[model samples]
Target: MTRWDAVRVRQGLVDSCCSAEQAGDQALRRGRPREARRHYERMLAEAIRLAEQFPDLSTRRDLTLAFNKYGAFWVGAHRLDQAAEAYAEGLAVATRLREENPDDIRLLRDLRFGEFTLGEIARQTGGPAGRRTAHDHCTTALALAEHLVGTDPHHTGDRRELGVVQERLGLLATERQELDEAAEWYARALSVRRELAAELPGDPRARRDLGVQYERLGDLALRRRDLEAARAHYDESLSLRRSLLGDDPRDLSTQRDLSVVCERLGDVALLTDGPEQARQWYDDSFAILDAAFGPKHPDTRTLRKKLRGHPVTPN
Candidate 1:
């Protein structure tokens, strides 16, 4: 092939990857995880091929992004193992890229994003050791985020990431039973998110980030068995989520998030009110999930189990 033809061919592959990733994102937003997976697979395959053939900066960057996005999708689908594997792959690629371009802000952020994601997955995997590893990884990411923010105080992306890192650090502290430290981190993150959300009220991503801070606080309160505090935080989260859902009811990802808040509220209700009140909350969650993923899906099935057995939630 002529050099011109080769360039065109590679460009075509890159275009295909871009389209596949967009399609995957759309599918995920609409609550069609299975459909999203197919598009993500296509995007990942093209990205890998491009990197293998070219091994150029652009190609490698695309490869890392593909893995990271796929990892995010797996996280939404509640597949921690798949999420971890994808994040690890992204980290491996991003580590080399960051070393080569230490001054490149985007590359540095990519590496930190990978580390941050892997840290969350480590916690989800569950164990004393896992929590310790998560704490270390997140602490490293927190320092990096702080450096990024310090370098460019006005950089919105850096600030946003800093908030997310703080949120995770708060969760890690909560795991270690350091409630005071956790509250401090959560407060810092909340302030950052409030700024971002106020700056971009129409941006769903910004609003969701803010909502997540409240949700994390709610989870912490529940851990303390403070039902009233948990309910208040969850109510705030649910309000933000509901507003987002109202903007786009067809968004499955948002629906899932709403369901989580609803279910958590149900946990609070079960403790405070009774089975009947909690049942109503559970039904609300079930309705959303059943509509989004059908009753046979694992999420719905787990909800059903909760309804039937009413197992005592440790939280």
Candidate 2:
């Protein structure tokens, strides 16, 4: 079958789920966690039912995608345990596929993605023990990603995966308080992401990844109390995120990112511009999040608490 035909077939296999997943994603971006979770659960159930009923390649791939999306949704909601479980489920499926088709690049890539995601969740919740587990998973993921890139240097997806692995290594190093090592890994990730963005200027995702690397660098600088460096990095990240938002105003995730950078800018303003300036920054951050996710969302609530000392202008 042609690639387009295969895509259509896959869509048909998962059509019952497409609307639920889309609704879930929209709710997630809008910051309604409960609603998003409900929709995602329905989507996952549908995916699982279809996969079990058919047990075909396309259906299995759809199932894997559902699990991965579920994991991502949980990660955004800060439900690390759920994220881990979902990722583990996806990993199991991917592993089975890889074992059956050792030479299939797509299956291998899926397996690598699963490993990397589980590693990330582990790093977030497993504490020191989790970090170790994350390190091992990331290391293996990096090796697989490298092999894939070497096999197909022109494949942008493989190259992007390599960059993602490097960024994870940077995060692991930061968790260990290995500043120099963290910087080294972050620099490598930035280099790769920048190259990809330059090559594909129209690729918003590539630009977003580049923004993420800058934000990571900004975070590391903040931890080190390097305010100037943090400010510069965050400014760059904000600019990119703003451009992305301008390009797609309906993207709630991008809107959330604007809130994040605004909060960071608030931090810097607090340190450099005193109470009034800081309040303005914080207010901007809170307003964006409040509009998207409502005032009761955990993130919006947390930002509200941060604004406690300041007089909040009514939205």
Candidate 3:
């Protein structure tokens, strides 16, 4: 082909890749899963072709993004096998890129994300071996996040990433019933998240993230029978979550979070404030969760079990 023909072919390929990516992202934002899948699959195909035909660093990077998007789509769909395959493929490409450019911070961050996602999937799909493997992967991700935070302490994203990794470690410890270790890890994450929330007081997402840590800590306190401490944490979580839910009352996840915190507070009240106060809290939780998730849902069912012997009046 002539020089002009070659340039035209290259431009066409780039346009195809760009268009597909844009379409996929737009579809996802609009909650059109079928359209998103079609666009993402097309993007992946184009990326793969570009990677092979061009064999350049930029093309390979695009291919890596394609794999990551494909994996994330499958993960959201709960297709674990497909998610695993996509992640593995993307991770392999990321690993290669990391080897080629060890100092590339972008590649390092991508690797951490890939590893974290894979570990979470393993953790959710339980087995002794799978859990152990997940722990290892998450530990590696924590190390990477720590290093990144050390490199840029003022970077909010890096700090949040470190906090999340610490939280994951705490979860793993909790699963193993290592209460002391779990508490220590959670405390570290809580410190970071608290700082982040304070730094960005206007950001609801940051506050919500801190609230999550508080809720986890509350759960830990309950496990340790520290009723007062549990109440304090739950109260803090409830405050933040209420503010978040106030901004978007229709967000079912936020509503569910508020319900969980209220239920925990009721558990504390049951022990100290007697059945009347406890009953009020329990009823409030039941109302919220029953509305957000039907009475037959697991969350509502668990709430029912908790209220069984107590016999609270349903609203």
Order of candidate numbers by TM-score, starting with the best: 3, 2, 1
Task: Return the TM-score for candidate 3, rounded to 2 decimals.
Answer: 0.89
Model 1 has an lDDT value of: 0.91
Displacement of residue 70 (Cα, Å) in model 1 is 8.9
* Candidate achieving the largest lDDT: 1
Model 2, residue 170: what's the lDDT?
A: 97
Off by over 4 Å in 1: 1-101, 309-315
Looking at candidate 2, what is the lDDT of residue 137? 92
Off by over 4 Å in 2: 1-101, 310-315
Model 1 residue 102 lDDT score: 85
Q: What tens-digit string does per-residue lDDT give for candidate 2 at 170-233?
A: 9999989998999999999999999999999999999999999999999999889898999999
lDDT for model 2: 0.88
Question: Which pairs clash inside model 2?
Answer: none
lDDT of 2 at 290: 91
The alpha-carbon deviation from the true structure for residue 188 of candidate 3, after best TM-score superposition, in angstroms, is 0.8
Candidate 1 per-residue lDDT over residues 216-287, each given as its tens digit: 999989988989999999999999999999999999999999999999999999999997889788889988
Report the C-alpha displacement of residue 273, candidate 1, in angstroms. Answer: 3.1
Clashing pairs in 1: none
